[model samples]
Target: MYRGTDLPSDGLIAVVKRDCPTCVLTAPVLGDFVQRTGLAVYTQDDPDFPETVPGRIDDTMLDVSHRLRIEIVPTLIRMRGGQEMDRTYGWDRAEWERVSGLTAIGPDLPMSRPGCGAKNIEPGIIEKLKIRHGETGLASRRIELGGGEDEIEAMFDRGWSDGLPLVPPTEERVLRMLSGTARDPQEVIGLCPPDLVPATVEKIAINAVMAGCKPEYLPVVLAAVEAVLDEPFAMHGVLATTMYVGPVVVVNGAVRRQIGMNAKGNALGQGNRANATIGRALQLVIRNIGGGRPQEVDRATLGNPGKYTYCFAEDEEGSSWEPLSVERGLPQGKSAVTVFAGYGLQGVVDQKSRDPESLSRSFATSLMAVQNVKLAPACDVMIVVCPEHERTFRTAGWSKQRFLTRLHELCEISGEELISGAKGIAEGGPDTLAGKMVKKFRPGGILIVRAGGGAGMFSGIIGGWAASGARGSSPVTKEVKT
Candidate 1:
């Protein structure tokens, strides 16, 4: 089990076995030789075997046996310090004599195979592993900001970022952003996952700035960092999953207007800085502090563009129903952000439907399709109902609960509709929309909100596979900064 280098400068021979008659018979002679030569003697079954021997032995010997294919009894091992120098099995008297030579064991011996002997590792390989293990004392490494462009590029080339150009986080910039918030820069926001590195407000602001966020967006970013670190969120799993899940930020209250976030037409698309940067800022924090870079530990397959930026405001003014935050029991007029690890948007456009029932039916039919069924029924969904559709629902005198109830009823399908004949689908099932929906239907899975422009009769659905069950989807609300 011992590597050769783990041994003392002066070599020692250790005989190991548990309850073996041969070992018992040979103990006295071995003990005398050990005492005379001042060599270390170790027994496999001795209560204090590691202390008595030059080489340590434990359960790891079993691991070593598996690696080296050792399957014999009465093993005699030679060591210096705690490393194995040489080993022999089955009590070969000639081999024992050869190992017990007066001189120290030479590296030329047949047993001295690279790591087998106490060879020091190459410095370059050791350094690489240290970096991979995050043992560079990275936390202690001063956050240097003034590296030249070449140096910055080198850091990127060395696989440090999430495949985008970074805004150099100068000390001045970080401090200026920190000044926007009341929290201490050194105060720990939370430990980012995969690496479990401490995320200070200073670090968060630096990343937020890197993500092109304005100073006022710092509070929302801070709250998001806090929410993901909440034990239930399991940021580690979310960050590491092979699924295309990324954080979708939903903003509410007066902050939406103050920050100039888009809740109107193409809110999920581009053209709004506040919406884009807020979500981008959180993602940057996750990448920089949380260590969730794509393709490394991130491991997302067919990752969504939302991985870039997915944040939008609730269109409270256009909505006929209550806002999402209020539905989750937050007080009216409270500014908050609801974050979800979604697989991106599923656009539900129905320009032909004017009646509430027709619109609801269209949405339900779209939702019961194959892609929507990818999510578990118990999972929470964010339904972005456009103003045109909301107006139609209001004109029909349908409450939000009524819409939710109808949606739940319509979303249900039979087992045959769910099967896609793909590897993910259930075996021996029909491959229809009704079958798919029925297989994964759960009541109260829809989360409705009013958003988008008055021009289109379109809405969008953001669905998830599972509810994260007391762990995920507990939307955290933080007051937006002025």
Candidate 2:
């Protein structure tokens, strides 16, 4: 039942659009009906639909269309005392005749014709209409704009952007985004850092809408937010430092394919909506809800583009290794998201290293340059092995464990070259740490995931924020609670 107020009592309402062929065909019939019963007709797309009908209630703004949940145009409703008695959409001669009590029909009339889609449900209009009509219940402070004010500029003036244009978080779009989760709107997920604001589901949905996320992708975004907010992830420190660090999200399991994420070919770059917006939504939550903006709490010297968004799915099908989430203790087939305090991408190109040993050696050499060439055991690293490289390892019958072991072995460096005075550095390794071999990553600290296109011989690396252990951020994995 419609909860709207002020409905017509005991009347015939014909909802129509001029562009619909069915409405055009039945316009003459409706004209005759108007003359007979004095029907109250409404036009959705164009008000000047039927020339014979004297005036059409203009529904171009789609307030009436959305209120009544009209999916198809040319809908006829028989109302009695502010209540719908009967309703039918499109044109069916026998059905129309039975409902309208009219047997008259022109020879040009067909048996039946389907109506066009309602203008309210069009791609971008519904959300805006819902907000304009004040139908959705928004808890945030509403900003009233005058006729002279531009909304985009107003958003910029209010500092609600990440150095880019944002999708207006109208009440309707936020409400639609909230539909993705069954949790209560006011339920607190966690406390976001910097200002330590409590992030509710509704607030997260608002940011997700601003990030241009589809409703189906909201769960993954929510999980990614939760992952970053987890105490172990240490997002507050990640944002406050001067290191080139930000949250790098890795989505695993069925949710990756369910949301149409890009795991192949330019996966790290732009073009995929789910991969892009999900990451952007997390960043927006940190900025808008958490109060971590640049020059304030986010004191990075040179933040990377990944700070805007750096999310991608693993190519589980294309790889021989176990899925990242499964390796991280998530049940097989369950969807999960892991957040890492990652630096930026560093390409490791090795086209000629076909064998696993030689390839692992080259990868370890590139991994040495994470913080610096001499900086060993400084921080953990996320190795994104490309498909071509994965195939080379798979063909040689080398397991993921073997690859990691070989990489770890090759990454071990002598403390002699890492010391300060030996390398002529201002700050370097301790004298007690000199002359000893240091491993690149602690046990299980080396995070590896397979992604990217089949064409590239290059794998990628994302450096960690600080040394693995009590000092730096640790990766946190959370189940997607849809």
Candidate 3:
């Protein structure tokens, strides 16, 4: 055996994945070797591989896989004192005999079998691992505060805040925030747009601490971050566009009560810690971790106050309708967070409307004018039904589907009224759309959620960005799992 000076004194390590046929073929032989020589085994994929064996080290995160530069599974390497000595890949009986020094290691084994590709190097996994644990992991420059300097002022000096005093993210605070989940602190969540900086879990926790989020809010914040960063959400475009759009988050299921998020009266407006900070944490992630700052990466002409914080839980208990997450096809009772790219909230007031059809018509009337009265089929709308409005609909026994159908029907505009030369508005609808009752939203475009106080006959409309493809953002929902 060619023993290198750097080899670990700890004997040998066997790396394998059950999915590899070669690994499966070599497992019994390795088990035999383990009984004979006490071989240290690491399982990459299925931890239960070598079923009858014990003491299998898990390399599911691929940390050990990358450290050894493993390109093939079923790799047997001799090591001593943390240093590599000799290594062999696949199930070559002769090579195993040479490496393990075991005679007739596997009498029934085939002469040779090639190994499978290491899971570490497959597609996006390597890049993600590197970003998480490598030396070059964090790209942002660090800021050191002076002894006498106020931390808030320091944040202002560095332009690290969203024009408000932020909770200082000290090492202790960040560490405490990271305690909310068992995931590695350095695990990269995804890339933030605009600057396209990598958002690691630790970095997000740091921002979450700064956002005044409680430790329990960490999972929700993480899910919201994931929701927005999803490719379908088009977070990059949402931040870069001149539109008034920002992320609107709706929390559902057990997490709403677990985190004490306000899903009832004043849900959308304010006065809830979980609701407020959860949303704020995401914005801070984009601004600090993602490098999206107004006058910098973010170019919103007139951003709304919701930009500061725009998250609320659905008032599922008070409303007769199904929870937003349930309606969106998520399993009932599963906690989730849904993120939508939306402009500021436009209040839909119908104090006089006493019935479901009338209230829905009022909503359709107001929704028709979103972005522009003529912006039909161009954007989607999220209708937040207040408790009072929800009662009216429930009393009338109107399903969400029925209400949406009526709104879609009422949103159609006459072709002549929408065309270029009409209404003295140059940015008119196309001639091709003339004389047609163009639906305002696409099929299933209207999003509905029940929230707010029981007193007022008021609902809310959150206008969406452009259409739902590459040019615009589609809402994304992610289950919040601790």
The candidate that wins on lDDT is 2
Candidate 3, residue 282: lDDT: 96
Per-residue lDDT over 1-482 for candidate 3, one digit per residue giving the tens place of the 0 to 100 score: 22233223667788888889889888888778878888877788988887746878777887778777789988988776565667899888888777776787888888999999989867557656655564333433456888999999988888778888999876556656766877777788899987888888889988998899988999999999989999999998888888888999999999999889997788887789999999999999999888898878788898788899999999898566888898888998999999988867789988888788788789988988888875667687788998888888888998888888888888888877778767888767778876687777887678999988768887899988875545688888899978
Span of ten consecutive residues with least summed lDDT in model 1? 112-121
Q: Identify the candidate with maximal TM-score.
A: 2
**Which is the better candidate, 1 or 3, if ranked by lDDT?**
3
TM-scores of the models, in the order given:
0.64, 0.78, 0.70
- Residue ranges of candidate 1 with Cα displaced over 4 Å: 1-155, 158-160, 370-379, 416-439, 466-482
lDDT of 2 by residue, 135-200 (tens): 556678877877999888888888988878889987777878987888777888899999999998
Q: What CA RMSD would you report for each candidate?
A: 21.9, 4.6, 11.9
What's the lDDT of the predicted structure labeled candidate 3? 0.83
Candidate 1 lDDT: 0.66
TM-score of 1: 0.64
